[model samples]
Target: MLRAPGVYRPRADTRLLVEAIREAALPRGAHVLDVGTGTGVLAVAAARSGAAEVTAVDVSRRAVLTAYLNTRMRRLPVRVERGDVQDPSETRQFDVILSNPPYVPSEQPRPPERGGARSWDAGSDGRAVLDPLCVRSARLLAPRGTLLIVHSALCGVERTLTRLRRSGLKASVVARRAERFGPVLRARAGLLEARGIIEPGQRHEQLVVIRGDRPEPLEGPEACGDGT
Candidate 1:
């Protein structure tokens, strides 16, 4: 896979997300959306997994171009767009949504305006992007759609599942892997320990893939809200 400078390179998290998508066993004609598609890895996986339509979105120009090139090179039917998934104007829903968004907690007040850090840096608690994504997930999904998102356990996996459930989706952890702290996270170990987000001497973080599923509407009387 060709990657532009600073774009997120496919790693364990990416591989896990791909695995989750394949296990989903979605119908062939399903529409799929890949948000924060750094290198289009997940988008390509969705296409190969049988999605009839695949849309990949990213906020970085280089990432958008990289994704387009990768998909185009593979001759996959993926639409690459330089846009934010959290945008309100994005009303088109999909049968499956894949996201490996920014989850690294940073002391910065906002995500980076440019450079590689933008791909993984999220404000303070790391929920800067995660929170919004969880809140907007169900809206972006079509009925019976599935949302596959990967993030470090340091970001609070339960918080993500809880937020998704509150959005009316059935959410759960689909995959997890413990990995030694990478350069980025390793550099923040002191701060993380100080903040109590991780135990002192912790040199590993568990990455988790959370699946949020939007269920189909109930039939008959169940469809009616409130017995009254």
Candidate 2:
């Protein structure tokens, strides 16, 4: 397993996203981008699944380095970069984009600027990253591209679906797993309950994988452009 300070470790949510990626049936040599690739687990999985190219992005330098080292150890040709998915600079659209961003609701309006909390503490509504990610995913995907994102249901699953659908993409919940709250969620249980996001004494949250697919051009088949 990969190890790094301030980097998110592989967890149930990560596994759920990986399983969803496998079920997506991506075309051979499809270009894949993994946003918030904490340990590059999904990126490595995509490479092993026959992706022609895999690129991973994260806002944390430590996360980028950790992912880079992890992918290298597996001998996977994953390109790891320090960047935010909401403001990605890469012009090429990806055939598949995967993300497991921070979704735990926090009392603060913004995520921490530094510290281990950045790995899981999202804003007050838990949409700080998820919201922008939905907007950017539409632009980052190529025609007929697929986007798979995993987040806690407490963050508003319907909201994510609504946002993606509003962006002209077909979105749905593809997979879900109910898991007991870990350290992060446990710590915020009171606040979440107070905000009525969770039931009193509730100790479990459902993690869902939302899939958004861009429709192919109707004017005739289009060739897959090289993902720059």
Candidate 3:
């Protein structure tokens, strides 16, 4: 139940993440990592779907607290931490990794509700946080692991793929919502325009879920009796 403009809502992208993870068919009791788990929705989903362990992390203290309470209320075995993805000391890898990161491009005014830009804005080009996130993900994921991210299509899916490749990961788009949403990719567009990178009215796109895999192929999880 992440309220306001940028925080992730459980019913929104969590369903996409859960369905994808369930389809992966990992062995029972496998470890799953949920990054930027605002309300622990995806973390809880991973637990419900039979993940042996679910570790969630968020940069915001409030978000961490909320997720902690939610997980406690549900009695789910999830470890919630208040930390930034950029920290080098962050360890604890996993078989599966899912993230609904702050993909909104920077330069956009912070929403009045104040979930705080830390939960959203990706910096002047929107790639600030995304780049580091992907880089760290490459090192953090276990061999033959999978990483899923839901972001704006306007952020240059092709560029994201290129970055993933550079990070030694193969990227793919699992789902996309075709509609107008400036809050998603406006920063990339703005930055490009400022640099004469692209012209205005370039037909921005909508939201999309991106899945990147390491060089080692992921072994689909074994089906649990009640994954449906």
Which of 1 and 2 is ahead in lDDT? 1
Compute each candidate's TM-score over C-alphas: 0.94, 0.93, 0.77
Which regions of candidate 2 fall more than 4 Å away from where they truly are? Answer: 218-228
Candidate order by lDDT, highest to lowest?
A: 1, 2, 3
Best by lDDT: 1
Worst 10 residues of 2 by lDDT: 218-227
TM-score of 2: 0.93
* Model 1 Cα lDDT, one tens digit per residue, 1-228: 889998998888888888888987878988999999999999999999888989999999999999999999999989999989879788898999999999999989789888999889999999899988877777878888889999999989889987787777788998999999999999999999999999999999999999988888622222342111
Clashes of 3: 5
Taken over the whole model, the C-alpha lDDT of each candidate is 0.88, 0.87, 0.69
Instruction: Tell me the deviation in Å of residue 72 in model 3.
Output: 1.2
lDDT for 67 (candidate 3) = 85
In terms of lDDT, model 3 sits at 0.69
Ranking by TM-score: 1, 2, 3
